[model samples]
Target: MANQQVNRDFLFRRLHSLLGVVPITLFLFIHLTMNAFATKGADAFNAKAQTLESMPFLPVIEWVFIFLPLLYHGIYGMYVAYTSGYNGSKYSWGRNVMFTLQRVSGVVTFIFILYHLWTAKVLPDGPSFDMVQQILSNPLQYAFMIIGTVCAVFHLANGLWGFLIHWGVTVGPRAQRVSAYVLMLLFVVLSGVGVSALVAFHG
Candidate 1:
């Protein structure tokens, strides 16, 4: 029984990690790319928005592909963060940072997502260019959005390393170390794109 429970938990953790990557992280990239359209101008951004928002069955897609996976990943991630043996002091500097940051950013991302969705999706303005611009124009809101973007992006990028490891794809210290550096670069690039999009909207 004890062994079964442990096995279940181990499998759950992998699913939780996997969800963070596939639709969750992939959606992030698409979101950032769409937002990046703002850099070109409002017409470009709004047109792209229209294209996406007009997609048939977008609501279902959002719920099934994006929101469902995110909901599970965030909830399970919070559970694991609280219950796992993730002692920062037990591991080396790399593991220590990964463990601590994973928990911290997971919490931040969870809290931030509600505010983000409320502002970005639930507003009276909908997904229009003016809607995003109006919200980001507020300096405090701008800061919060930037911070939230960092947390969300970092959580995914960092967790991506764990996902590869969990799947036995990147086994061994040398591989993980190399992957960490690569993912760190990915995090920075994604964060830059997200922040830049916000900045464009702010203008």
Candidate 2:
């Protein structure tokens, strides 16, 4: 009875930890899709920007919904990763490589996100469509954005793969191998689309 109780408690904790990733992933997809609108020209991109800015209490809402939750999710994710003993070296070679890539990409994404928010959301001058268009017009900014998009997509895909394993969907060795390859392919394609969109952006 004691052992059973301990097992149940462990499972509960894990469930709580794993469940938080779902909403974060959902938001990531939404963000990526929205950003891809940059490919459609300034008018289209600015329309979306105007819509977001036009929301009532926009600043407060952004703090509550975008910044706060993102900070919490990132901290919590790192905690779970550490406590779960998620050492990539113990996994298959492909999984290990993906794991390392995801972590490195996550750091890059974090830096990119901070810069993006600074330039596009939180600056004292307020975000301007003209300013954004000018930034996008730069080759360096385009390169940074392309790298960030690829990193973000791969990180999300790898996280989903890890989620499957956590949920017991990819249990045996063969299934794990297959899922890893499939997710890698999926992320590569998704990243390609995202990079192309960013590269195509014009004022």
Best by TM-score: 1
Give the per-residue lDDT of model 2 (tens digit) for 79-147: 544655445766767657676776677667777888877866667355444676667788888678778
> How far off is residue 116 in model 1, in Å?
0.8
What are the per-residue Cα lDDT tens digits for candidate 1 across 1-203? 89999999888877887888888989999999999999999999999998998899999999999989989998998898888676677666777877898899999999899888877878656587798888878889899999999999999889888888888999998999999999999999999999999888988
The runs of at least 3 residues in candidate 1 whose Cα sits more than 4 Å from the true structure, single-residue gaps closed, are 1-7, 85-92
- Relative to the unseen true structure, what is the C-alpha lDDT of residue 22 in candidate 2, on a scale of 0 to 100? 49
Error of 2 at 196 (Å): 2.7
Q: Report every candidate's CA lDDT.
A: 0.88, 0.70
TM-score, prediction 2: 0.73
Model 2 regions more than 4 Å off: 1-20, 56-61, 76-92, 124-129
Residue clash pairs of candidate 2: none
